[model samples]
Target: MTVTTQPDYRCTPSPLHAILLAGTVPLFLGALLSDIAYYNSFQIQWTNFAAWLIAGGLLFAGLALLFALANLIRADRKAGRPVMYLVLLLVTWVLGLVNAFEHAKDAWAVMPSGLVLSVIVSVLAVITAWLGLSNLRSGGAR
Candidate 1:
């Protein structure tokens, strides 16, 4: 007698896909920093093009994040507000950093508490964003 084994496949969508995709804060930051690096590396003017690239990336990323959250929240999704709130907090922290960078040497270190707070805020934002997106994507579909 011969025995054969069957393979099992999952029909449900992956929640982690949405989680990982939505959690692209680092990618966005990379784009922002790359814009700066482009200027420095090429001896280009900051006001000419690099700033625009960074600004555009930031705008698109922020809008995409907002829209994704809106879709999930409108679908009666759970555990989304905390993430959105933290994203906003991150924005505020970034704005502060920009202003501080205008004059402070070692701007990120100007306030030790702020540096710590920024990291905490960013980590919370990413984790919450992932959790929220994960909850949105794992449908009950077959």
Candidate 2:
């Protein structure tokens, strides 16, 4: 008798994951643009809008990262440790939260560093999410 084993394929990502991955970059950019507008024009209202935009994007991106981490853990128990991704996401989330708070309070002095941090985090998140999504789609089977 002969036995054959087939490789297990990962499942496609959910709509929420897709949305989070798709929206994160644009949302981050929009927030950045709003910040620029506010800073250049000294418009308090624009800063408030930017703060909320960043907050909302951070929420969605954070959720997406959590979902990706869970899926990675389930798909490959031995080789699915995404520690860097997790750390970066966490840092991004924290920085974004602080930035949002500062923007809300019109603390322009400290907003630039937060904005830069947000951009860095957003880029890293996009890369990580793309890789995770690709792995899911490709079945990441050994």
Candidate 3:
């Protein structure tokens, strides 16, 4: 009798996925900064900038979330970081959408809530990006 073993393979994000994931952090961070400026100066322009930045962040995070879902589906082991990453990305994308809606309101009305949402979304984006880009590997015999 002959014995055979399956080769070990690793699951990781593609280059494009990494780029999209990386893009979310900066855009969200920029939105957070804009929200801070708007809060401090009460400048409507700052709010406008924040809205645009949040939109861009949402776009990137949405794409990254799709990639994360794909990866989660493809991964052999889905119990650890992969599941957490997908959940975080989903939460970030959803909250980002809500923040966008909040920003759509009047500049003065966007205060407090919008800023709070921005802060949360920004932190989530950073965490999602970090989780997506880090060296998380799952390898085993197929």
Candidate 4:
């Protein structure tokens, strides 16, 4: 009997993965902003509409990430990592919206989920950009 391998899926960057590659940096910055927004002012400032806008943007970002993931996963052996990263980005994007709009009455009490998404987008920017570039390099994008 001949043995078959499951194909090499190690370290291949997915389009989504690359998108979130910049998230780590902004994550820290967002943390700082959240801290300031939460505890560093004499007056409280919050708005549901702003949060709603954030939710909408995050939703859009999630879609973009999903699109990138699909583009990177076209029967290629180097898309495993990128797929995982993209999924993570999707999850984070969804959670970002939830965190943004969970409480109708106490949105101010909640951290800016939009801030989280911004960070996500920022950090993932490089990764996603690279993944896209790599895909182009390989002519894997359809």
Model 3, stretches more than 4 Å misplaced?
Answer: 1-9, 139-142
Alpha carbon lDDT of each predicted model: 0.41, 0.65, 0.87, 0.48
Q: Per-residue lDDT for 1-142 in model 3, tens only?
A: 9998655455568899999999998998999999999989988999999999999998888888888888778777776677888998999999999999999999699999999999999999988888888866565422
Locate the minimum summed-lDDT window of 10 residues in model 4.
Answer: 133-142
**True-structure RMSD, every candidate:** 9.7, 3.8, 3.3, 7.5
Compare the candidates by TM-score and give the number of the best one: 3
Per-candidate TM equals 0.36, 0.70, 0.88, 0.47
Best by lDDT: 3
Of the two candidates 2 and 4, the one with more favorable lDDT, higher being better, is 2
- Model with the higher TM-score, candidate 2 or 3: 3
TM-score for predicted model 1 compared with the true structure:
0.36
Off by more than 4 A, model 1: 1-47, 80-142
Off by over 4 Å in 4: 1-35, 46-53, 73-75, 111-142
Model 4 per-residue lDDT at 12: 42
Overlapping backbone residue pairs in candidate 1 total 0
Segments in model 2 whose C-alpha atoms lie over 4 Å from true places: 1-12, 80-87, 136-142
lDDT of 1 by residue, 81-127 (tens): 43454465356346534523421333223333433333443454455
List model 4 lDDT by residue over 67-137, tens digit each: 65665666354435456456655665665555455423364554454455445644554354444335343
Model 4, C-alpha of 14: deviation from truth (Å)? 12
